[model samples]
Target: MKKIAMTVFLSTAMILTLPISSHAGHANHQPQESKELLYQDMLMLFLLPHIDQAVHDFYAKQLTASPVVYPYQVEVKKAERVGGSRSFHFLITLETTPVVGPHIPVGTDRLRFEIDPTLPGQVKLIQFEHLKSHELPPRWRHMIRRPEAIR
Candidate 1:
């Protein structure tokens, strides 16, 4: 719980300071973001609340000998705004390193989400796919996704 709170706090702090940081070079003039950049920023803001949950879910399924380390890594490979629309497609890699055992990476995941441009907070997952499987943990409830569903 503390970890989650800290993660959320740090993320929020980073976001809150973003505008301040950007103004270092042009203190007198307000910066304008490009269309693509704006879309990307919005997409990220929408994803922030869900990020911790996504990481938790990934680790839950990974199963490990110990309480797999908290705060796994997430790499954003792609964040597409979907043709000037509110819909977005994301490719992310979530990895974990065990504290006392071999690591069982969660591999990459592809996600698609649709949101009302006006209300980016309300997001619906259009698609969610784990790129590949990982090693089973001490007692992972192995569940195999259908081959047809993988793609």
Candidate 2:
């Protein structure tokens, strides 16, 4: 009888505290994590459009049309929340090279992008400099088509 009473009391106490502890944790850090994820989203949004521009600037005067830019690397310069507001911003640079029959170009480009979630992002071409390169095996290259490309 004593053992049963003790067990029941402990279970009741634990059940009662479950929500309070959960609420405490949620109240403390969950919102911050959400804000961090918002910054991450801002980073992605800032990166997408600048990629083609990077390719264009890298191959300027070389290719009459914009070649497919293979984004070899991504660098996030800044990602943070706006001052006392629900806005976010990201400054990012994308390293890219033109597709030249699997040969690396003379140098790659660093395309800088800045985005204010309050407004549309803008594009800028920073530079073209030679960076060391390595090759990686195709992870998902098997999903291939002959003439056309997948978006």
The numbered model that scores best in TM-score is: 2
Root-mean-square deviation of Cα positions for candidate 2 versus the true structure, in angstroms: 11.3
- Lowest-lDDT window of 10 residues in candidate 1? 141-150
As a whole number from 0 to 100, the lDDT of residue 75 in candidate 1 is: 38
Query: Residue-wise lDDT of candidate 1 within 54-147, one digit each (tens)?
Result: 5446545443222333333433454455457654433333233322234444344555555544545556555556666444454442332332
The parts of candidate 1 lying over 4 Å away from their true place are 1-35, 64-105, 117-121, 133-151
Please give the TM-score that candidate 2 achieves against the real structure: 0.39
For model 2, what is the error of residue 140's alpha carbon versus the real structure, in angstroms, after optimal superposition?
Answer: 27
- Give one clash count per candidate, in the order shown: 0, 0
- Assess every candidate by TM-score: 0.35, 0.39
Candidate 2 lDDT at 87 equals 46
Residue-wise lDDT of candidate 2 within 1-151, one digit each (tens)? 9999999999999998885434344444543458756765565555655666655554454433344544233444444443546645544555555444344342344555555645534444344443532232364233233212211
